[model samples]
Target: MTGVVGPGAVWLVLRATVLVVVAALLQVTVAADLEVLDGRPDLVVIAVASIAILQGPSAGAVAGFAGGFLVDSLGLGVIGSTSLTLVAVAYGVGVFGEGLRRTAAVRPLLAIGAASLAAGAGQLTLALLVGSVPQASPALALAIVPGAMLDVLLAIGLYPAVRLLLRRRGPRTVSLDLGAARV
Candidate 1:
């Protein structure tokens, strides 16, 4: 038990630390716009949500808070907005992912849709609170749908790869036959 717990604890801490650092770096260096469209990929948000889905809601929430706080600290937008958005996104991904996991084909698509919805809704809510809703043609709400769809598409392309890497390297259990191993 001690062996299991100790290693698991270490792995968890290490994983969380790495996730935070990577997310922060991505947020700081990567331009949100992807050139494919006039927008950038929300890699930080997606990372947080993916971690949460893979780890569970609590881990996701923690990752979300850390990632969002970092994003806010960068002065991209009002503080707490990203935090709130990420927490919600993480939770939704964790919950919905359970159901979607049953069908292999649907998991990626579901992740994409859920991730986009969470990010767009969070951003829209922030815009409303900050009173800077984009008001030109189609209105801000209309943009949310398309923006979220784009996010989903991006997630579909990226989530599978991330998932595969995470799963492949995840902690494993090994047994050694000590008595029979004497050479």
Candidate 2:
């Protein structure tokens, strides 16, 4: 398979690296302190999802893993839980994003919402599996709903910025474009 090799690839890597680092840092420092109805927005999820949707699955998965690792390392919880969840969520979102028409508006928002829910559920389930949730309580509702809401809300603003940031200078073969090859 032909791939981006050289300056474009390097620039993409640099941009993605910078984005993941900044998002993770902001997540740990700024977003960690804010609470809305006992829910804290996850900027890392937003970043990963945005990247996944904009760049495609592989990029999304890498961004997810990187951002998740940084957040997990900085915060308190199971070591690989967030990373695992983010990787899966980002990849799925990326795959889903690749199918949509470029002009579609609401679909990206839907993708963000699904990604938020999946990320929240995946992490919460992992926490439960590791016996880290403490006890069966309203923590499930508190953790998923409000946080997902905040995630989608934030994505409304942030996703567009990420989309603009990741505008392709030239097309790279990130995913198959079935529509491009018409008989």
Candidate 3:
């Protein structure tokens, strides 16, 4: 594992904070009005997952917590519910990213999809635990799928920019390989 210290670490933290805050703002503003099949895309979740995969578990957890807290505060939901769910999702994605090769071009897209589904499930489970929802109705349960789809679609465009913003000292190269290599 590599460690960034001194001013570089500070800059990294600042950049991550800005990214999460902007995502939260967009989520509450623009993204809130755009719904697909009664499900809204979560920009905060996408941002947190993007940062986590690019950075690491610790950074991911921190970004997730910050983003979730912002969403909760802005939307007036249970204060820590989103924060808790996002923490797990971000950390999990970060760990998964760590296990992959550096040149895995499609990792961001895959990670975003998985993170979105996991975040939806976590939020639903937390809502159930908090007694916010009476029960897991079919509509509510299925809503998660559409949200995940929307998140993936958004990530398709957002991921590359995120990757670029978080890029360290390296050449920019991305390739989508569908594993069609013939031995």
Candidate 4:
């Protein structure tokens, strides 16, 4: 409303871009390679989900696409596959948030955990669909919880920073149904 594109939206997108890119770089250079508790924390997934929780489905999907593309490009993976998985994860989480009347501080935690699990599962499923047998084993199932927990921990800090960056004087994000969390 104020500019060709509202300054708020531009700031939000810029912040998201920085967060996604930085997190992906960290994931590629550090986090993804570092094993903790038998699994790695998905920095890009956490970052995208953190921003999506604030930005809504469309923005979330965009962040997801960027983060996923970074992973696909920076690491050994098929293009568009990780992108598709993260898009679904971001979109689903944003839609779920849209139905809520309010959110507690715990909401971000829950959302991050769910998104992490979903991201992991989505990646696995898409890989399988593409004929990539990713060495499935019993340990893989157990890693889900650890990975999600680690992601939630990372998101605890990441979400607040993203929310702050995206914050505007009034409501800036458009929810799917014009509803938003009271938090």
Candidate 5:
């Protein structure tokens, strides 16, 4: 199976798996309470969504599922909530790639904003749906905004690196001319 797998497919799987693990570790260790303006930056989701959008719907969906699952497992948030939100955001971003690719600056900003909003809304909706209306804390919301903004900032900084990495891992196509002279 490994021998049969295309280089690009293998790279994507390996990259996605590594990213999920790193993101989970970041969420558990470095990201804890590292607040900016009271917001907790969600780098994992933003990175996952940004990459997914750059790739395609299928890639984005896979990344989203993995990222969300990692987030749920590492964070104290509800299960499946982040997963659902990430999947939706990844698909949405992937669908907009054409337009986004046209405007390079817009992509990161949009990815950050969309991922942040989706994550916040997802958590809120999950809480409500589960009949556990944890008292909405204004302080918590305030903290989250800054964190989300930080995530956006991080996305801006990291997009190029991610693109380069993906490109390096992508499949290469070789072209041959049938009518050319043979040595």
Candidate 6:
């Protein structure tokens, strides 16, 4: 984790840890109760995507794993389920950002929106593979859109906050006009 960013390892880890923890708590306690077209906003995916955008794929993967573990342990569902889904979310967002990260505001919104669908699909696929298939219906497909919209709305606000929090602090480099300096 530290190697990915270079320097201020403690600061980065602490910030990521806090972000993940809060998101998990919010997901389980708050987000779980809220619904959007029969789906709830995925705060976990939002947090993971936000970090992945700032730190890249490796960091995002690590954060996803950690956050997933926390959520799983909280006894929401099958072990490693959320973790796996979030890992995919983090990696997908990170990879997406790798190519077009410079677009700023739009990138994070789209990344989170896309990854939200990926997370739901991944979870459903995994659940089916494990023989614990959740109820399927047309609502399931429709739910992804609102869930994605919620994620986008959340990411629109969250990505910037996370970026600001994890921003590297250092002396600003000044380009001086010393080209004509006398020896």
Which candidate has the highest lDDT of all?
Answer: 3
Number of the top candidate by TM-score?
Answer: 6
* TM-scores for all predictions: 0.73, 0.84, 0.86, 0.82, 0.78, 0.87
Clashing pairs for model 6 are: none
| Model 6 steric clash total | 0
Candidate 1 stretches with Cα past 4 Å from truth are 1-5, 100-105, 134-137, 168-183
lDDT (Cα, 0-100) at 47 in candidate 4: 82
Q: What's every prediction's RMSD, in angstroms? A: 4.8, 6.5, 7.9, 7.9, 4.4, 2.5
Which parts of model 2 are misplaced by more than 4 Å? 1-6, 171-183
Model 4, 1-183: lDDT tens digits are 121155566665676688899988999899967878777899988888876777677788988998999999998779788899899999988877666433346787798899999988887777666778667766766668888988888777777777776666455675465466443
In model 5, how large is the Cα lDDT of residue 55?
Answer: 72
lDDT by residue for model 1 (2-65), tens: 1124445666656666766676677667645444454455667667766666666776777787
User: Candidate 3 vs candidate 4: which has greater lDDT?
Assistant: 3
For 133-154, candidate 2 gives per-residue lDDT tens digits of 7666675746687888888888
Off by over 4 Å in 5: 1-5, 135-144, 168-183
Per-residue lDDT of 1-183 in model 6, one digit per residue for the tens?
634444677778898999999998888888888996656898888888888877788888888988888878874677788889888789878877777654488877888888888887887778777878666667666767788888888787887888888777766777667679733
Candidates arranged by lDDT, highest first:
3, 2, 6, 4, 5, 1
Structure candidate 5, residue pairs in collision:
38-143, 39-143, 39-144, 39-147
Score each candidate by Cα lDDT.
0.65, 0.82, 0.86, 0.78, 0.70, 0.81
Q: How far is 70's C-alpha from truth in model 3 (Å)?
A: 0.6
Q: What is the lDDT of residue 23 in candidate 2?
A: 90
lDDT of 5 by residue, 16-101 (tens): 67866787678767876677666777777767776676677667777888888877877766777778888887777777763676
Clashes in each model (backbone N, CA, C under 3 Å)?
3, 0, 0, 0, 4, 0
Cα lDDT of model 2 overall? 0.82
Cα lDDT tens digits for candidate 3, 47-166: 999888888888899899999999999977888899999999999999997887655667778898899999999999999988988799888878898889889888988877887777
- Score residue 149 of candidate 1 by CA lDDT: 61
Q: Assess the local accuracy of residue 84 in candidate 3 as a C-alpha lDDT between 0 and 100.
A: 99
